[model samples]
Target: METSATVAFVVYALLFGWRLVDAVEGSASVAVLAGGIVAGYLVADLVSGLAHWVGDRFFDETTPLVGQNFIAPFRRHHVAPREMVEHGLVELVGNTAILALPPMALAHHSLRPDSLPLLFSGGLLLSSLAGAVCTNLIHRWAHMPRPPGPARWLQGRGLILSPERHARHHRRPFDRAYCITTGWLNAPMDRLGVWKAVERWLGRAARQDPR
Candidate 1:
């Protein structure tokens, strides 16, 4: 399943790239395409943060559907951060690739050769999915003692997640710097106490639940 998903993801990504180029050559606005790509990255970063926050806060590793697969690895990462570094590429990206497929397929199908709006929106969605696919690998690199040179360069420039930025999340309370994609939203989100606020709201709602 993982291998299949990974192959599908690569194929879809290549297809999207080919279609995007054709759209551009067909007179789609370069400015709109650029804006979509930028927005996609930002949205992907925000999503990574939210998923990190939720996985860290709410569910345990035994919670049925997401238990062993999602929640367990997330919980274990805090105890054994380097374990992620040891994961195979397919192990690291397979689940995210599976998660990203439906939307990616929809966007691919919706993309029209002559429609600039479809091109822009499809570009945004596809780029966001691409970022999602890369998120785990990027996170793994941040935990590595000596990541590849390209990753190191990107980390230094703050273009992707960095060990220095991610370290704070590993500190006691394990609460800040949840944005592990580019780590761009971490500071502002932490300063605003967004996760804390959400936790508090969930706490209140849970207490009032009849279940």
Candidate 2:
């Protein structure tokens, strides 16, 4: 896992450099790239919330790959929220790196300098990939009683998950505030009743007759 994470990091470092130089020399405007990055960050927030909700509610520790890799840890977290702080960097970032490798590779091969399509598509994917990779670190900070001064500052500014905001999820039933990266989408997602809607839909599907 550590090796895979290391390889993934190297790949991203190289790809970022390549894209940076290409965007500078190629036709894609900086404005377009910026838009793509913002969109990507938002998308990552939504994805993080969805994934967290599913892991928390839909499965158990006995379930297979997802069970062991995702659901089990979530279950453990409900009992010991601080466990995340003990997690090694490899555990925090490795699996995400594996998931990110493909999209980063695709962008590297398919995108070109100055192209709006490249900026919109490739930039969105790469930036969102970055956000996803940062999820664990942000979550750890949320759990800390007193993270570093800089981290506290960022959390206070709402640039990252704040301890007070994340505490709601740690409350009994563990249902809301699932987005841990930046915690930007939790309120909107909760207000829209998105996760409840998904649960009802899935419950209905599970009850359908197989015959």
Candidate 3:
């Protein structure tokens, strides 16, 4: 499954790249593409935070569907934060690659010549998936004793999640700094009490549930 997902991810990524280049050459403005890339990064960060929050706060490792594969990893990471560093590339990115396939496929098929809007949207979707595909690797880097020089540089500049920023999430309560993609949204989201509010709502909903 991992190997297949990785191969599919590579194929879709290449297709998206080709379409993106074609769009640029045809009619898409550089500014629009740049905006889409920026928007994609922010959206990916937001998504990472929401998924991280859900993984950390809800469902046990024994629950159905997401239990063993998803929830367990998040739970284990809290106990053994450095374990992610030992994961291979396929292990790190395969699941996200699987999740990314549909949108990537759609973007590849939907992108057209001289259509700035489609180009912009395609750029946003593909870039966001690209960010998503890199999330686990980025998270692993944060836990590494010393990541690659380029990663270290990005982390230092706050262009990506850093060890220092991610450390707060592993601390007791484990309720803050959930945006593991770039850490750009962590501060604002934490300050706004977004996760806390969601937790409160979920708690109330659970209490009211008949199940």
**Which candidate leads in TM-score?**
1
* TM-score computed on alpha carbons, candidate 2: 0.86
Query: For residues 1-211, what per-residue lDDT tens digits would candidate 3 score against the true structure?
Result: 9779878888988888777776675333777877788899889999999888778777778879988988889878887888989999999998999888878877677666366776677778877898898899999999999899999999999888999999888786667898999989999989999888877877753221111
Better of 2 and 3 by TM-score: 3
The local lDDT score (0 to 100) that residue 42 gets in candidate 1 is 86
In what order do the candidates fall by lDDT, top score first?
A: 1, 3, 2
Q: Per-residue lDDT for 173 in model 2?
A: 53
Residues 107-176 of candidate 1: C-alpha lDDT, one tens digit per residue: 6676664667766786788778998899999999999999999999999999899999999889876778
- Residue range with the least summed lDDT across 10 consecutive positions in model 1: 202-211
Pick the winner on lDDT between candidates 2 and 3. Answer: 3
Off by over 4 Å in 1: 25-28, 204-211
The count of backbone overlaps in candidate 2 is 4
RMSD score of candidate 1 (Å)? 3.7
Ranking by TM-score: 1, 3, 2
Q: Using TM-score as the measure, name the better of candidate 1 and candidate 2.
A: 1
Error of 2 at 180 (Å): 1.2
TM-score of each: 0.91, 0.86, 0.90
